[model samples]
Target: MTRSVSALKGQDTQLNCLFQFPPEQTYNRSVWFIHKGKEHESCLTDEPPLHITINYTERFSLAANIKNGSCTLGIRSITISDERRYCFRFYTNENRWTDKGGVTLRVKATPVISELYLKEPPNEGITNNITCKVSNVYPRESLNIALCADIVPKNETLSEQREPDLTFNVIKTVVFTPSKFHHQKYCTCNVTHSALQQPLLKTVIIEFQYNSNIAVGVGITTILLLFIIIIVLLYCYKQTKGKGKAMSMSSTLPTNNAAHSENAVEAPSQESQTEGNIVNEHFEEPGLVYSEVEFSQKEKQNNKPNEDQQMHMTEYSSVAFRKY
Candidate 1:
């Protein structure tokens, strides 16, 4: 059966082969050959000591112990061209053995994924470009690359260049148009190859400027509400001030009316008092006349002396003074 050997480019690899022979028989010579498409080409031969063929460097070596029936071929600094089948053949005096199902060398190079990013900063309603780059890839045909936006596949332009060492460098670019809906969405790149067990991924966020329409609307609404509150407060303040003035006026009206009514009552009482004083003076006039008549009779008696003393009894007097 065929044996498989896996190695990476610029690394060393070995192919191990084993065979069994009887104790009486021993291997005389052995050779290692590599399959070149449809033909076998000898690379190493061991008549007694190992011999490397032309176009092969010391990097290609063979270690063998024929009596023990083991042979191994080592290759250093392997390349993509070294990926092929290797056969080992042995000969003895009795018979010869050539291994047709040989060991296959699979050379691989791990692709390096670069950072995924945008060519320019994103803005709303603007077109942008997203890029993903991969380098150091061997067997370029087996490399697969994909670009996605928010987990959805996107159309991209694939470009590749051959490296100086016969490897590949690839670039994948996709055009992206950003909107408010895609502000926080993600842009991702996925890379897969036969050499990698898991796909490589690089992701970036699609951030952009937001639309100002909604913000402006909200700001206007807030200002309008503030204005309405101010107007209502002013109206309430004016109404309250007006009510205070009306209450003050109403409170003073009753006091003024009561004072006027008291003054009107006191004026009639003062006039009636004056009229009563005049009537009392008119009744006292008779007493004053009787006082004057008594004084005249006293004066006439004094004129007559002792003769008037006998006349004193004839002189009648009623003196009524006004009561103090």
Candidate 2:
């Protein structure tokens, strides 16, 4: 049996050899060989072949499930030197021999990481560009690379280009605008190959700054609001003070007016007392002269009176003179 396998470099490769022979003719005995440089190289036999090359000794192994008539070669971490053709043969004690299909092992080169960048500036409302590239990918295999954004917009997809296996770094640029919707958006780079369905994704986050105009406007508006509040406070303070003063005046004015009226009435009473004394003195002295003439005539008529009656009259006249 012969087998061949093609795998990317630094990857594991498996080769299978299929052979069919009569069950009675061939037992479980099988021999696997490697042909390199136009020479047959013995690799493994039923007794475990000895003195294998250093490159194949550790990483190469064989599996034979003879019941299924199949042989498998497993190569781990394959390199360029591992590329070769292999052959398998089955032998039996009855002198019967059967050959299996040969195999060719090919190693493909691994792709290289290319360019990576952000699509746009790290500011709000600006379009950002994110790019990722890989070089030297196998052309025979379908290469699917994707650019994933942390925020994937509807109806948006990544773009790609292809070239032959020689130094082809696929460049994909995605345009994105930073927004509140993409507050914590992440940009990712993905790569897919024929053997792997799930893509390998690399993520990067794009940070956006707050909008300066909005911040400044908010600050200015806040200041203006504060200023208006202060003015209102001052006006209210003045109004309160004026109201207090008016209240105090309205309560005290009636008491002051009543005190002044009481003092005015007392002043008039004092002035009237001084004028009454002056009028009484002026009337007392002038009234005696008119009555004197009439009294003289009455005295002449009473000349014949007794001595005792005359004494009483004299006393009465003296008292009256003093009282006046």
Candidate 3:
């Protein structure tokens, strides 16, 4: 086996083996074996007509010439499963030999920064997790993932192992406490791999939001509660005032009824007395009186009488009195 090689997946690579023996000895045949976990599997047997295993029949090829004393194994469109150590064994005439130090082929794939976003809604005064996802990376141990907030490192890296494809999905998370000062700030995700010439980076703007709707809802609820309390107080006051007025009116009702009865009885008596006085004034009659008197000789000397009417006559007088 030649020197070890680091090859990218989905590319072509070759392994060469060279050996020297005595001039009398001639090269017979060679076989290549791949190292599995605890065993080795024969991949190709290079005899006269180079034969390969069922798995490598399509994409595996070999070129060898005893004159050049070299055998090269070619692989096309390498996959992650092709990452293993390959050993070469050969038999020359009567001697069998094998190369113990096999060639190690390391397959790698570039890391792709697929997404960088917040795992939860960013609310002011709360802690949130920002996640960065990297996909399709091979040789998971070679992946270097990081998260940054404004160029400051704050990250915890985790990876998910996938089967059959031998690829990995990496997740990196950062803890952030949102505040008014952090609005519109940026967070970056960086990924590096042996297959990549430069680090893959993804930047996202973090926007923290205020919980104004919740505050408004709480305020409205408080106002409604206060208004209900005021209305209840007013209703209770009105009911109390009405009850007091009712008690006062009930206490005064008997006095008012007695005074009304007394006035009703006295009104008829006064009207009847006035009518009796008018009748007495209309029926009253006038009165008359008469009196007789004699005069002496002294009263005749002081009085003068007509000489023509002085013949013999009797003295008489009449008087009247008024009735009221």
Candidate 4:
């Protein structure tokens, strides 16, 4: 039977071959590798006796468990250079030998998958993008990449890419419209490859934010604005009140100044008049004399002379006494 084995680097696999011999004899077996008809690697002699070599350099090792002319070769820690066809040949001490079919090793690169995340976290009932990035994938034909969501019944393809290294990458996306109904649903990425034993998966839970926190934030902001307005109004009112008080004080100063000026003028005139009257009354005898007494004691005391007549008499007495 013809068979081929595919594996990733740093993995192990079995290469089994069977043969028939006539009788029990000391048998020597060796596994030889060929790539494109060119000999590249070899494992010579018995079970663990041969050091596995590639390009004449020791690079890998294999162990064979032989029972009843059948062998199972265990290849350990396979590498990319180990990709080739290996065949087993057995030689008996009786000069009987045979070379038979074997396994073709096809080493493939491993697929790398990124985390699944929401494209936009803060979106409403509008559809948002969910994405996962996969890289470094080989054997593109058998690779299966997809996006999965519980809310929707379909898997969507967002994008795909191929690197210059001939390795393909995929960008899978799911268009999801979130509402309050889907507040805690989840999305996942499904990656399956021929080289992987189990499917690689990544998941992200969807979160739909309600406006209660936003409403609370707005309420707090409005209250702060009102408080600031109140403070500004109080400041303006105090400023206006202070200006009004200053204006009133300034206005009253002129009135007080005018009243003081009137009093000053009237005071000096009254003093001069009183002095003149005393001078006129005393000039009649060159001694002390009461100006009011000039009215006379025989006249009506309660009905004394008018103020104009008394003043006239004071002036007349002064002039008359001077003539005397």
Q: What ranges in model 1 sit over 4 Å off? A: 21-26, 39-57, 93-95, 151-154, 210-324
Measured by TM-score, the strongest candidate is: 3
Candidate 4 global CA lDDT score: 0.62
TM-score of 4: 0.44
Per residue, candidate 4 scores C-alpha lDDT tens digits across 1-324 of 336787777678666666667666776644444423334333322332243323222444444445466655666776666677765555677754434345678888788786578877735556777788888777777788777546673346756677765567877777666677667776678899887889998887777875666668989999999999999999999999999999989988988998866744222222223322222233344554433323333443455446665565545444422233
Clashes of 4: 0
Clashing pairs in 1: none
Quantify all predictions' global Cα lDDT against the true fold. Answer: 0.70, 0.59, 0.67, 0.62
What TM value does model 2 have?
0.46
Tell me how far the alpha carbon of residue 50 in candidate 3 is from the true structure, in angstroms, after superposition.
15
Cα lDDT tens digits for candidate 1, 1-324? 577899999999788888876667766876776644443443333332333221235887765665678878879999987888787777887876777677888888989886688888876555678889999898898999887646322456889998878889999888767776677777778899988999998888877764467568889999999999999999999999999999999988988998866744222222221111111122355335332222343354443335333233223222245545
Instruction: List where candidate 4 sits over 4 angstroms from the true fold.
Output: 6-8, 18-31, 35-56, 61-74, 88-100, 106-112, 125-127, 135-139, 151-155, 158-168, 176-182, 193-200, 209-324
Q: Each candidate's TM vs. the true structure? A: 0.55, 0.46, 0.57, 0.44
Top-down lDDT ranking: 1, 3, 4, 2
Ranking by TM-score: 3, 1, 2, 4
Question: Clashing pairs in model 4?
Answer: none
lDDT of 4 at 80: 62
In candidate 2, how many Å is residue 114 off? 4.2
Poorest lDDT segment (10 consecutive residues) of candidate 3 = 272-281
